[model samples]
Target: MFLAIRELAHAKIRYALIGLIIVLIASLIFIISGLAKGLSADNASAIQNMKADYILMDTDAELEMTKSFISRTDLDNVLQMDGIEQANSLSVRMMNASVNGSDQNEDVALFVTDGDSMLLPSVRDGSPITQEDEAIVDASLQREGIEIGDRLVFGEESELTVVGFTDSQRYSHTPVVFVDGGGRETINAIAISVDESRADEIRNAVGNSFDMVTKDEALKGIPSYSQEQASLNMMIVFLFVITAFVLAAFFYVITLQKRDQFGVLKALGAKTTYLAQNLVGQVVLISIMCIGIAMGLTLGIAELLPEEMPFLLTADEMVQTSILILIVSIIGAFLSLIQIVKIDPIEAIEGAGK
Candidate 1:
């Protein structure tokens, strides 16, 4: 450790450049990971927030809620199944809503279920919807100039009064508008709270026409959710691979520069393990310092972002990714260690035969 520190102090400029590269790569990983998580939450938070453990959809629809259509009879069959506690028919449709007097029409995802259903958002600021044409909307609408008691026209004849707002209840990247009054015809998917032990039995009882899937599984059926996540996750993978290669190359060059020093140390009674430790310790120390700086910068960037732009970095995500960075850095440092071990003390003392 002392030798590693002394070497770093002696070659401050060289190590500083390496540290800068590590910092840039680490920051890219953090930012890209946060965006991946943020986009996922934006696409699925509404379903993720629900208490229901399973979604019952038409089997023919292949787990997609929008493509699935369950009738009143299909819901009844599931309700009668063993271990089922609660079930509610949910309908979602995209519609254009104009603020009472303005020509500006916003596209909103309309959610309709039974008035007394648990699927309804418990109001955060105002009263719950108790009648037809009365609705609760995601809080994001507040940013769009929507206010409580604002009447929104759904169509020429259909209009709704905004009765309440729910916190962050977005679906498929769109703000959700929860309403009442659509009967069996509007039933698209059924949300169910089921006993885990009897989950298989429940699915069997629902028959061949319906499929029951977990909440996360249901989200993958959303058109944009899977594709967006895959592309972003692939970007993160590439960034990690690039970091490994860059660190390996940088450390290899540094090792070459110190070949003579390592040879002298070995001739002076230094063990191969000791030289390896010093080399790896430098890599670890540099990685920690760079990663720490990257974290602080990432938080500052997050604070400056507008709420509409999703960039969520959770504690678990940071911790897990940081561990990965350390591991990959250590792997890269091994390249230097191998060269150190291969050094011949005789040849090193003889000055490379020159």
Candidate 2:
């Protein structure tokens, strides 16, 4: 550790340049990861936040809630099935709504469920819908100057009064408006809560007409959700690979330049293990410092971003990324150890003298 610190102080500019590269790469990874998380929430927070364990969709609907429809009889049958704890109708629709008769309209996702259904999201402000035509909207709609008590006109004659606001309730990148289904004869899907032990029995009882899937599976059924996540995840994987290669190349070159120094130390009784420790220590220190700076920088950038932009950086993700980067850096540093271990002290010393 002492040797590592001494060398870093001696070659401050060289190490600083390496640190800068790491900082830039790490910061970019963090920012992109934040965007990925934000997009996921923007795309399916509504479904993801559901208290239900499984969703029952019409098998013919191809897992898409928009295309699925279940008659009230089917819902009742499933509700009465053995091992079924709770079940509620879920209807999803995409429509344009004008606030308080405004000429302009905004796209919104309408989620129709029973007034007292478990599928109903608890509101952050105001009250949940208790009657037909009353609704609770996602808080994001507040950005468009919408507030509690504002009337949302759905079409030529249909209108709804916004009675409350819920947080983080979005679908397909649009804000959600939850309204009472008022015992509608048909529903888009069924959200159910059941124990894992009883899942298979429930599925069998419900029959082959409906497909039962977990919440995550249902999120994938959302339009473009799977593709978007796949693309972002690929980018993150590539960034990690790039970081590994960059660190390996940088440390390898630095190791080559320090051959004579390493030879002198070895001749003076420094063991390979001692020198290897110094190398690992330097890499770990540098990685930690750079990653810490990158995290702070990324957070600052997130603050400057527009509210409309999807960018969420969670502490868990930050920690996981940092740990992965650190491990990669250590592995990269090990690549340089091969050169150190192979250095012939006599040859290196003679060459330096010549």
Candidate 3:
């Protein structure tokens, strides 16, 4: 530890540059992770937070929710099965809506369900929607100044009254409006919140009856969400791999530069295990510091992003990935140590020329 620490302090300029590169790499990995996570959330937040154990959609449907439309009879069929606690029919439509009295006709998405079992985006400002024309806009939409009691126009003329504000609820990156009732008269899907014990029974029964789907199978129903998430995740994986390579390469070069010194220590009877320990210790220390700095920087970057950017962070993902960075750094360090094995102890002496 002392030798490794002293080396970094003595080579401040070189080490500082390496630290900066490492910081950037960590930042890149961390930010790409946040963005990837955010993209998945933006594409699936509403469904992710729904108050349902199973979602009912048509059998053999690509996406069981929006694209798979079922009628009231289909919804009724799901409720008849034993072990079904409760069910709510839902409809989601992609269309443009705007702030009342504002010119910005943003792409507004609607989640329409019967008033009995309203699911995503619990009520915050006004009452859970009861009437056909009443709507509860996601709080994000409130940023546009569409408040309760305001009239929002959906699809040119379908006027919906903003009855309340729900928090951070979105579907497909578009802000959601929760309309609790026949949902403009179209029952596209149903949400079933059932106890786990009875889930299998209900799933088997309803699946046989009404083409019901569970949460695991339902996410694909969203338009392009799977493809979008896959693409972003690939980028995130690439960034982390690239970070590991960059850090490994930097340390690899440093190990080469110190090869003669390492040889001298070996010739002085210092064990190879000790040299390897010191080298890896330096990398571990730098990795910890660099990742900590990058984490702080990523937070700043996330805050700097606009609210509408769909940026999201979760403690689970961040913690899991932070550990991943450390583990990957160690992996990188091990790879760089290949140079040490090839180093000759004679390099430490006066050489054969003497």
Candidate 4:
């Protein structure tokens, strides 16, 4: 460790260049990861925030909530099934609504359910929906100047009154509007709360007509949610691989340049293990420093991003990315250790003398 620090200080520009590359790669990873998470929330926060453990959809719907329709009879049947703790009708619909004060019609995702359903989001402002025509809208709508007491005209005669506001409620990149179904005959699906142990029983009780999917499965059902996340995650994986290769090549070259120095140390009784530790220490120190700086840079850029941009960075993600980068850096540094161990003191000394 002492030798590693000394060498790094002695060759600050060379090490800084390597660190700069790491910072750029790490920052890109963090930013892309944030977009993946943010886009996920924007696409399916309505379902992600649901308290239900499982959703029962029409088997023929292929996991799509909009295509699935559960009759009132099936909902009752599931409610009476043993081990079924809670069941509520859920309907998702996309429609354009004419904002009361604006001439433009905004696309909104309708989340219709029983007024008393636990699936209803708690209000962040104003009162909860208590009437069939009353609705709680996602807070994102506020950016467009929509507010409580405003009316959203759905069709020629149908209108919904905004009664409350909810945070982080969205679907398919549109803000969610929670409305009371008012004893609607059929719904898109049934949101249920049940234990994993009893999932089989619930599935059997619902019969083959309906499919019970977990939260994750339901998220994939949202159009483009899966594809967007897959692409971003793939990019993150590639970045990690590239970081490893870049570090390995850089350190290996540096190791070769210091062949005589390592040879002299080996002649002075430096063990391979000690030299290996110094190499690993340098990699770790550089990785941590670069990752920390990248995190700070990424977060600062996130703040400056536009409100419409989907970007979210959680502490867990930061920690995970940092750890992964550190591990990959160490692995890359180990590649250079091969060159270190192969340094022949006699040969290296003779060459230096010549």
lDDT of every predicted structure (CA atoms): 0.87, 0.92, 0.77, 0.92
Report the lDDT tens digits of candidate 2 across residue range 68-115: 989999988888887888899999999999989988688999999987
Counted clashes in each candidate structure: 0, 0, 1, 0
lDDT of 3 by residue, 75-95 (tens): 666678677788888888888
lDDT of 4: 0.92
RMSD of 3: 2.7
Once fitted onto the true fold, the runs of candidate 2 whose alpha carbons sit more than 4 angstroms away are none
Off by over 4 Å in 4: none
Worst 10 residues of 3 by lDDT: 180-189
RMSD of each: 1.6, 1.3, 2.7, 1.2
lDDT for model 3: 0.77
lDDT of 1 by residue, 1-354 (tens): 999999999999999999999999999999999999888878888888876888888788776778888788777777787799998889888788999858878888888888888889788989999898899999989999899999889778989999999886888888899998546564889999988898888778776677778888998888788899999999988888888888899989988977887888999999999989988899999999999999998889899989899778998899899999988999888888899999988888788557
lDDT per residue as tens, model 4, 204-249: 8777788888889999889999999999999999999999999999
